[model samples]
Target: MDKTTTAAPSAAALAAGRRAGWLRELRETFTLAWPLVIAQVAQNALITTDVIMMGWLGPKQLAAGTLASTFIMPFLVGAVGLISAIAPLVAQARGARNIRAVRRIVRQGFWATIILSALLIPLILQVKPIFLFLGQNPETTMLAEQYIQIGVAMFIPGLAVVVLRSMLSAFNTTRIILVLTLAAVVVNAIGDYLLMFGVFGLPRLELRGAAIATVVTNLFMFVVFLAYVLNHKRFRRFHILWNFWKPDWHHLAQIFRIGTPIGMTVLAEVGLFTAAALLMGLIGTNEIAAHAIAMQSASMAFMVPLGLGVACTVRVGYAYGRGDDEGVRKAGWTALGLSTAFMTVSCITFILGAPLIVTIFLDPDRAANTDALRLGASYLVVAGLFQLVDGAQVVAAHALRGLSDTKVPMLVAIVSYWFIGLPIAYVMGFTFNLQGVGIWLGLAAGLAFAAIVLVIRFAMRERLGLLRRTL
Candidate 1:
């Protein structure tokens, strides 16, 4: 009887097979996540360096820079979300071994980037009137306008880098991304110093100088990454740029269809934070400066989970393309677990080291910094409180993206952040007089809500019919 058909594998054997599968998946996820994590941290380092230098220029300039950033980030991050559609799309094509599809998706990603940049640049350039209308301090608004005028030039190249980086991430060629970003950090620092200080005979442009440096760094990154993608032997075979001027309206529309919700989702969340910043602006210059420092600290820690979330999208997209339900489950859960664990560590660190972290951005010895430093430390503790939920929400949202499930998540974000989060922030900070900390508490509440809902949706993917492929 063919040796009894080798007997159905014992329960123990099946258990061992599962254990091995989990271990293999964990390894793969870690490999993919580490480079992305480092790259993200390095990218943030570029921003942090600017913040530190801004602080050196004094609290007033720091506040101005923060105001400018709050305005710029919503548009920039939302556009990055749009360009990031290339990742899941390319990963799925790769999973199906469809080379032409990969090229088309990437080419269209570039198209989306260019189009978005054109629309956004004009809007961002009008920040002066917008901020003035919003009742921002006239002085800070003027300074912010000065900074943004030059910085907005980075918009196109910055979005282009997102498209290229998304393509590279899907292909698991992230080490080069890491190296390039790290180099940019150094380049940006040097540029910031020379131009901001007028060192080495360079003219001092101050805040405008910082903006120029950032634009140069972004342009450098885009040019180098594009060249690498076009010439690298591994990627050249796809001929992503071969058509140059041809349009793929189908894939272009597909990118917008999938990406618009993602951009809106990011905008909703970033908008909430921007609203909070505006609230802080209403409070005082010290509050705004403190909020900026605390936000930068939280954003720095957030990079790890964000990187893991991105990796999850690629892994889950690949599994979904192969129609391997179990693979998708493993990839998603493993990434969730890893992100949660890292965030737990970050939470503890923030709670215990808030003072130290605050001091990094503002000098405790400087009496001028006293109020901002104290407020920053307190805000950081609240940031710690929300860290876990923030990590969980990001990973869950990204996992859903792997399944091409974004529209519902966009609604979730709008409801959670705008409907639930912002009102609480306003009422608590102003009506209840809890001040800045209350605003932060509201942010925590929103993230916790998003975390719970999105995780539940992902957990019930099969039941909710979210795993069905629309593409």
Candidate 2:
């Protein structure tokens, strides 16, 4: 009997030990993740700020700005995803202590950014016809075109910022991003106030002014990040700017192979959301406004998981490069667990505070916004239900990217968003008479499918010891 009692205590002690180890890994992951979260949230705050200012202008301006952003966003986000290949590349190089590889990766990243910017500029310039083709309201389409024309100026600088931020964050120098992004947020808010309202002797540009403010903010952020990377002591070893402005075809090809699929994956996800936005426009202007408000709220909440996903890339990449498979698994799992926990809390908050959160974006006293506010509040509930799966999918996808497994995940995203999400959205919103709510439910279903498949992929790769396989 005494021996049996001792055996039970021993088993309990082992279980306790495993839990303690899990907590330690989680703590370390959070330590790296929080600065990234702060930076991402600050970065996204720029858009939130613009939306708030646009809302104050009127529903027409708000809807127009939101529509224009939807058109521009997929391209910008895809390019950002492309440039993000540099983060894992740099992290791996850092793990291997290969300064030359880091320099080569960043140089190719810069070239890709230039190439992507050139391609995207023409796309933004064609927004007028695109909006017309989509059958948008004529007046709103004209306003949206104007807004996008000005926003085009920010694209190049914004992509450059993405590359620089990736490099710095991969090096574990995240504090700089947090500081610079916070400063840019302040500048953006003040700039929008001055330009949008024409305060303090400035001409009131309204919607146009918002675009200008964003341009200035993007330019400022690029300059600051460039200055830091160039002048910082930490980067001196890599000789990052050696030959300054030359191209290497071989390295560029490597970047393209890895980054292009990543870019497409991002576009696939963004396309789903943008398509939903366009569908909302067809339903009605109020539906579009409500969709924008709910999406913006969900996006703000998403920043936390997005940042964690980024940090996981660095952690997992570093481990993979060092041939530490166990370390990679731990890092990946810790990130997923942390992300799920955080999103769980966010999900609860959104469900509980849906109305209060929606109220922040519009004037509650305004009769024009009544329908929008109601739809937005209800959409927040659907957003809440999917937050966990959304968080899981992003983390899993990023981890796979760290392992240099981009192509399969790209296919997963294509099937999940385009094949599954959109069809369901269309049928539910139109055919079934569910309208806007049905569309949102379809989004949740797609995200859930993505999360499940991605988690399985990650687990399979890790179990098979394929994570360390060369691309």
**Candidate 1, run of 10 with poorest lDDT:** 2-11
How well does candidate 1 match the true structure in TM-score terms? 0.98
Pick the TM-score winner: 1
For each candidate in the order shown, give its overall lDDT on alpha carbons. Answer: 0.93, 0.89
lDDT accuracy of residue 323 in candidate 2: 83
lDDT: worst 10-residue window of model 2: 462-471
lDDT of 2 by residue, 206-239 (tens): 8889899999999999999888888889886677
